[model samples]
Target: MLNRALRLPTRAFVQVRSPRGAFDATLGNLSAAGARLVGIPERTIIVGDWIGIHCVGQNYSAEVRWHFDDTCGLMFEEPLSEYQIMTILGSRVAL
Candidate 1:
């Protein structure tokens, strides 16, 4: 499914922390609104639940929009700076 609503597609790592615990995974695709995070094998997050996420060294609040085994989409609560976004994308691409 193509989320055409997002203009820019980037890649970054997403850090998710909930009541359960904390985990980090690569978000292979990103946008200003949300991101498609990969490498997550756990299903402890719930949709619409607020979470703390770190990407490109910048931390932000986000909510779980959707998820599946090893993959998920998180909607950011705040807008990220262009530099931050680019840095995240670059770092992920390099890996």
Candidate 2:
């Protein structure tokens, strides 16, 4: 079993980059390894699709792991450091 990182609930706008182009998404929760994106349109994304997520001027490469309704889970290509996560969150709130 994989150990889950601690997730912090947040409301921030995130940019999702796919082969088609970039789309706006809502960051509902965040962690070092993954995040929950809400308000994405249904059928717009699929599992295993590689994507880039941008928030607060920070970027992360990730893969789509799961989706339900308008929400999807993304697993980062590399786990983010705690400091990086905090910086993104701090900047988000500061905006």
Candidate 3:
């Protein structure tokens, strides 16, 4: 899938957490606006579902924009600073 603009598609293992409970999943493709993930819970988070992401020693909160089995899209509620995005991308690329 593609995201806003034209960021190179990158894959990463991300830890997704929910306020209602705990969710651990991997993000396969990511960009500045949204991402596609895998291993989403059976009680799948739907559009607008609030969530938190743990990556590269940083935490970010976002909302679920769309989802399918083992794949979900997220839009960061609070845009990450350039430093933060770089940190996440660097760690994932390094892996």
Candidate 4:
């Protein structure tokens, strides 16, 4: 059974940093536990790789969980609160 909370669809632009370097990606969906990203170059990252993600003035430590083509899934080191997720989304809208 899936145990994760429902993910909220979003189109926020985020910066991603991997061992290779930093790149820009689009946030597809987000939840307290993880996020799905698109526009990442294929083969640039692998499962279990540690990465840093920046979005809406917030920084997060995450681990790559899976990837397919240009999209990848990330699991956050520390889960975000519902309030925090809303705050980030709100900031993006306000900008």
Highest TM-score model number: 4
Residue pairs that clash (backbone atoms under 3 angstroms), model 2:
none
Candidate order (lDDT):
4, 2, 3, 1
* Alpha-carbon local distance difference test for all models: 0.71, 0.84, 0.73, 0.86
Question: In terms of lDDT, which candidate is strongest?
Answer: 4
Against the true structure, what is every candidate's RMSD? Answer: 3.1, 1.9, 3.2, 1.7
- Weakest 10 consecutive residues, lDDT, candidate 4? 86-95
Candidate 1, residues 1-95: lDDT per residue as tens digits? 86475545555666767656789877767677767777765656767778787765668787888877877777888766677677777775554
Measured with C-alpha atoms, the lDDT of residue 54 in candidate 2 is: 85
Q: Which ranges of candidate 3 are over 4 A from the true structure?
A: 1-3, 93-95
Q: What range of 10 consecutive residues in model 1 has the weakest lDDT sum?
A: 2-11
Clash count, predicted structure 2: 0
Order the candidate numbers by TM-score, best to worst.
Answer: 4, 2, 3, 1
- Reference-based TM-score, model 4: 0.88
Q: Any runs in candidate 4 off by more than 4 Å, and if so which?
A: 91-95
Candidates' TM-scores?
A: 0.76, 0.86, 0.77, 0.88
Taking the tens digit of each residue's C-alpha lDDT, what string does model 2 give over 1-95?
A: 98778999888788888766678888888898889999886567888899888887788898999988999998999998989888767755634
Better lDDT candidate (3, 4): 4
Instruction: Report how far residue 63 has shifted in candidate 2, in Å.
Output: 0.5
Clashing pairs in 3: none
lDDT: worst 10-residue window of model 3: 2-11
